[model samples]
Target: MQRAFLPSFLLLSALAAGLNEARAARLVAPATVQDTIVMRLPNRATLTLTVRDAAQLRQLKNYHLDSLTTRLATYITQAEAAAKAGTTNQVTMRFYPDKDQPGQNLPEEIRITAHKPGTDGEKGPTKTQVFLNKKFGIVTTKDGDGHNSFSIGTDGNATANAREDSLKREKRRRSASVELGFDIGLTTLVNSSSTASLQVPSYNNWRSTYINFGLFYVQPLHYTKKSKLAFTIGPEFSGNYIRLTGNDQWVQNGNRTFVETAPDAKQIQQATLYVGTLNLPVMLRLKLKNKEDRTTLSAGIGGFGGTRLTSNIKTEYRLAGTDYNSEDKISGTLNLTPWTYGLQGEIGFHALQLFAKYNMNELFKEGQGPKTHLLTVGLNVLGF
Candidate 1:
């Protein structure tokens, strides 16, 4: 058996989970100037973990208190066994960093110490990486080539062309693969101004939702292969919803569209305008950091142009005398812009990303409907 004891702070996280959420919050001290947190257990064990950067803050945000408590308990039990078999009373445990996983993510690290300072002190350097595949961990990494690389290793000194080559290899391997994308986010009007003649109701930004679905060809930028930049083209369909804040409902008269209060306002439950479009997007993608095929941090900026496919106003209401509810879906041109183009950008870790789009065209034709453009912000997860 080995003399082992984790920093006591990490051990508290396991116990803290059992407490009420409010109490547990008190147990976690805010990160210090050094971005390190030290948590102490009631048993006098303390744990300390350092946050390297703001990106690592996402890892902390992703932690699940429930699963962590269970893991900590199990780890403590294993330490007890190790201590019983060996002569050392000290025990140590570690947590790995999360690498853009879909489900519950991993915590960066937790150190628990049971004894006073320097008690059976293991002065070994804190190791950040763990390579379970020992056979693959070659002894020497003297050259730049990947002949002695570890699993999931990335060369920070890689040239721009090397990154381009990496992109090319990815394309060659999945050239036939179709990219399926789903985007969901919030929508708002850039201009909510209304004139005396045109009464435009302000939109409820928080309630307005946007969603999109797309199937596209992942055509990499062949011309930029020698450069650090990469580009792609794709096709897709997207939908936007604008929920008016007041009782005003959309009114469409031929090519003209405006908003007016409903006759029976009390009966209305929900009023929302929906618009759909079919789109073609050309994007420039850049990877900030990579872990083999897994890009740790990536970003993209692009533009899209799409034609309006469908437009309708949906209203839900309940009957005054009865408990019955009804929905009214009135389809129309609504004087909305026939075609639209916009600039979009995204920044993300792995496949989960945050995106924003600004529509260059107005939501409706000049002098019709609300004199406003569309702006959308939300998160997306990419898949093959």
Candidate 2:
């Protein structure tokens, strides 16, 4: 009887063990195929989720799968719209596991962040955050920064910034500025009769040291988008030094002017005539190149009126073969013109200008000396 009871116990134990093994096999068996969902976030990150089994995939379909897809579609639509409008946007979605299957592994919440197109209306970055309920505890995972970041598009709207910058530059270009210029040229007497007793020396004896310095207020005039003109008015200080070839004294005999050689004159070291004037110049300049260009071509025409500040004749001499030297500066003795007027013209590329001027008035007072005009040709160095 004890042997029979032992066999029954062994058989019962084997059956129970077999049943437990079958149950474990059913729980651990792999599903026919795995299903997955992939989501892309605004910040260029990817989120991939694998369903646990066929039952879990079915549950997702029956529960909130369609609604989730719909919500995501809505978010994309809104984000695209906002981008078109040059704005930013965000979206949030909830993914709930089936209440009937509390033990099912499913995400609890999903948050989507998107941005509108940038200034150019192009698609921007996105971010996604997923909250999951795990066996250990609730866990949070993020694929991106979860912030909206926009991209600049190629649309015309992007030009707004460029246009603003261009406007600023244009304003500066059109603003008022101070200008300075230097002039150097040959100074000579014109329209003089050769037989005149008070004739100035010819060009061979003339000094090419005429210099002028100017300071001006320049105002730009804009007539069109690409065209510009300027009005410049300035004070110019000018001086002319004329050197004579011979040792001669310029003498005034009551009313007549003559150059006389001294009896003791052996060698004429230097004889110079100096004239200083303060002039007022009015000019109009037309620019031939676009204002944006670094180098521009310009043409200018102007006139000047001036008063003679001072005039003098200086002579330096030495006795022939002797160390004796003499120098004399005679001022206010030459009957020079008290007033002067001239027409000036210039052509330039950028800062370098070639200029010419012709004096309309005589260099000396009428009937006091030979009738002569002043002609100047030189380079004008301009600065901003």
Candidate 3:
């Protein structure tokens, strides 16, 4: 890409003048030295580099700009000396590579047309320019342009291109063919069907943990090109672990299911109800990006419906002979509702994902057990 290298070149030249930019800008402490210097180029352009102090006079000492700054500094000094001596009208320097340039004989020359101090009081060059042709141009170093070693001037769009490229790379790295996610959250019931005679069990808020594990294959249905909106559908194999607090275990007597004192109620530690289901979720996602800044934010809302796969109660017991560590597993559906469905949503930026799910169906069939809706909330810590 063709660019205005001369502008940048002249800018660097002025930077190497060792002028105290900081001292020059102060109003009270006027500098003894001429800190504010200006150079008029033959192409009719003016370049300036302002700083607060001489601390960073050289600017970037190891980069291409530094090399150019040092070269311009040397050239200006020589040109001034030549103008004062009346030795010649101009000074020119041919740059040869530190290595070899196979067949090139005459290297690119930088010419500065010097002028003797006139009665009008001209102090510097009358003209200055870098040659650009088949044979004359500034040589970029082998370590130049982010180690590409072959770029000139600005690739004008380099900044924007870099950001977009990085964003694409991150998206590619985050893509998943099959997503397996785990949910770590707390569970609570709403609108409990508790009566004075048959009170529903109260759960320990902190101890009642709700966990979910799901495997899914996301299929985008309406993701248009260059669009921020997307609709996705996926089938997920899901498992739920709902823990209960207190000394009660699930008991199915005849046609109804309820919590009751177990055979070893005093020895029981924790009880959990486990449920498994196969769900189909349809999600509407809104994705956004700032191409210039290389940033992204995303959020999603979804609904899922599925039928029960399995249900069981797992109880932990503190036994006398053991170190308060004994386990019991009871396998039964316990009159849990056959159908399950819910609303779910998530919001995230970059790598963090947070989600919430609520089940609208009662935990058990009507007239069989307590009627309560399930709600789970937590962070989707791993994959999505």
Candidate 4:
């Protein structure tokens, strides 16, 4: 019993370890420089200041409109620069007081003064700073061309405050992660009446099973927390077995014609097919967070294109349901036609998912007498 259970135990243990590592990676922060705050005075002079994460976003409520504006402008400028440099993952903001501002009814303005992460002559690691002026509603980055930078909002004070609060909340959820993982799954082909003919109804029963394995990479989009994109590549193999039974009589012109020399009934045929496939799957994954911790609701749709590498078929026929009439085994490529397309979906825990796929292509090439399809259900594991 221990010997038989060894493989299952090892596979389960490997799955658990891989999932933990992937989850941990998601918590690590991508490398980035600290953000600086800046504000441009109505007098046209720019002032530099420091406002931490929450403080920076609370301008509409805690700080003067001028102050918040400075920080907001600096924040966005720095964010854009960071993205261009491929250093930061994403940047966002929330403007509050949402209603129109009273004082703003008059011509008033504030702008960013300097751009942070200033262009150091050399083009290597340059540190940018943001200047924030609480007194004047201006924001500037280390890179801005002039003091008339940009305004965070002309909305009501309350709305401005709300916007700042939203920005603070968004900054907290941001993260960058890298993952690596694998999944092993199985698939089976079921027998159906639509695929068989009357003469071979009993002898042409067919069913097949397969084992597949794969690897994947995943990246999440900040605009939508529910979805991510992933690419998976893998190899798979399948074993097909078929059984057929029929009356010893042969049919002619849709008429039941019995052979005088043959017995009333017999086992007509049996066959086995073996094939291998190489697949590349691309998919968009949607995830939902549950109220519970360490658990996530996940689903995805994947499209795969693959080619069959090897396929062989063998068959046996018996007469009168008793004596073997002929037996043949062929190693040549059966008309798997080499191409397959499918869509898959599933729900699962972090890094470990289970999905089912329905192949859209016919099993045989065109002009073949009968038609067939392939269906697969398998476990999908992701690392990211």
**Candidates 2 and 3 compared by TM-score, better number:** 2
RMSD of candidate 4 to the truth, in angstroms, is: 20.1
Model 4 residue 291 lDDT score: 36
TM per prediction? 0.53, 0.54, 0.51, 0.40
Q: Please identify which of the two predictions, 1 or 4, would achieve the higher lDDT against the true structure.
A: 1
Report model 3's TM-score to 2 decimal places. Answer: 0.51
Which pairs clash in model 2?
A: 42-125, 42-126, 42-127, 43-126, 83-117, 120-153
TM-score of 1: 0.53
lDDT of 4 at 47: 31
Superposing every Cα of model 2 onto the true structure, what RMSD results?
21.8
Q: Number of the top candidate by TM-score?
A: 2
Supply every candidate's count of residue pairs whose N, Cα or C atoms clash at under 3 angstroms.
18, 6, 2, 49
lDDT of each: 0.57, 0.56, 0.54, 0.41
Which regions of candidate 3 are displaced past 4 Å?
1-180, 196-198, 215-227, 262-265, 290-296, 319-326
lDDT of 2 by residue, 1-384 (tens): 224333432322332222111111001112542544433443343333344444443332222322333444454556446545553343333444434246544445444444443333333444333333331111111112223222111121222234335545745676778888788888776777745466665433345468999898889864233446889898989998876655565555665555666556467677777889999988888776664664467788989999999888777888777898788787884888889898999888776778888889988777887677888888887633
Which segments of model 1 are wrong by more than 4 Å?
1-177, 221-229, 264-266, 291-293
Q: Candidate 1 lDDT (Cα, whole model)?
A: 0.57
Tens digit per residue, CA lDDT, model 3, 1-384: 013244444544444332222111111112432333344334333333332343323322323444544654576567657777876533444443222343433223444444455333434223333332232222221110112111121121232234336435634433434667676877777778775434476666676666666765554432222224555566666666666666676666767777776665357788777777788877777655564533266688989999988888788878656676777787777888999998999887766677888898888888788778888777777544
- Relative to the true structure, candidate 4 reaches a TM of 0.40
